[model samples]
Target: MEETISIKDIFKTLKKRWKLIMLLTLIAALISGSISYFLLTPVYQSSTQILVNQKQSKNQLDSTQIQSNIDMINTYSVIIKSPAILEKVIDVLELSQSVDQLSQKITITSQENSQVFSLMVQDSNPLRAVEIANAVSGTFQKEIKDIMNVDNVSILAKAELKENPTPVKPNPLMNIAIAVVIGLMAGIGLAFLLEYMDNTIKDEKDIETILDLPLLGAIQKISKVHNKG
Candidate 1:
């Protein structure tokens, strides 16, 4: 005959192993918190915005020119991260990192059909991140004028140092929360696995199920009687 488990059985199993589950959950949370706070290095990010427009004397912009500027944003994004621009930035800032290394720290993004693009830099030092972001934008603006002969690239916003900048990575609370969930799942799975592996009979019901026989009766345990003095 096929056997089916009830909700009571699940609750019983959980109740029996709740201590182990709680232990594992606490251990996981501690480990995650430790890693987030002590092991992982904090990374700070700063961003600079650049505006792309045609240097024209006209008071109004033509739709064609606007679309052309929008299309050029992609090319500009690539050029901003290129060695041609990044090399100049490194030279100006005298950064210890190479062009490739600096490029890895930089990110270029723009809104769809927008003329403004943002350059973000991430570093361990918030001030360094801000400096790198601003330097990249300034260098790109100067280099683009020489390379593409386009004087339209202008620094819309420069990165500035903040009094208390926040790190972008190693979020301890979120990490601990995720770890707790994983620990709970793992602990519950292990509990069920241990229960499944155990073969010894615990009660009359287990004996009846294993032997395929009806339980007639159960014996009561006897305790030692104390002699009166």
Candidate 2:
């Protein structure tokens, strides 16, 4: 037989399972908050900007020279992550990580048609991240002169340690909000599924709907009581 649902039925199901829905939402929010606040490690990011300043013989900037400098930024980005630059930075900083491992935390970014590029590093320690960023940029600035036989790299800004630092990931409020939404959806779906699967007759309405029978009357049971005199 085909089953039809009404708004009233939907409301009835939700009302019946309100406790389950509330419990699931609360649990999800609590777990998400707990993981975000306690379980996950906070990562701090620091960045230093380097400029590709190619000296021109003329006072005004040359278009061809500017384009060449911009194009070379791509090469510089890769070179910054390479062992040629990272090895020196690691050795200078006395970092325990390998070139590949250190490279994973470093990101090189440059804007289109802009000579300035940023060297970003993320670490659990904010001061360490700053130190790594400055070290990598400084090493790249010094080594590029030897590797490419050009002295065009200049440190525009060095990464500085902040008085108070904040992590970029594992936002507890956002995580909890998302978890609450997912939990509500899951709880509602489960509630309807359970309601659909239950076959036991509970009331006169269920009997009438499932059995297709008219109830003349319902039998009432009388309770016996004993009195002592």
For all candidates, the clash counts are 0, 0
Q: Which parts of model 1 have CA positions greater than 4 angstroms off? A: 1-4
- lDDT (C-alpha) at residue 97 in model 2: 95
Q: Write the per-residue lDDT of candidate 2 for residues 1-229, one digit (tens) a residue.
A: 1244687788999999999998988999999999999999999999999999887777997888888889999999999999999999889999999999999999988887899988899999999999999999988888899999998899999999899999987688899999999999989998999999999988888988998989778767789998989
RMSD after Cα superposition, model 1: 1.6
- Computed on alpha carbons, the lDDT of every model, listed in order, comes to 0.90, 0.91
Whole-model lDDT, candidate 2? 0.91
Query: Residue 122's C-alpha lDDT in candidate 2?
Result: 94
Q: Which ten residues in a row have the lowest lDDT in candidate 1?
A: 1-10
Backbone clash pairs for candidate 2 read none
TM-score of 1: 0.96
Q: After superposition, how far is residue 21 of candidate 1 from its true place, in Å?
A: 0.6
Considering every candidate listed, which one attains the maximal lDDT?
A: 2
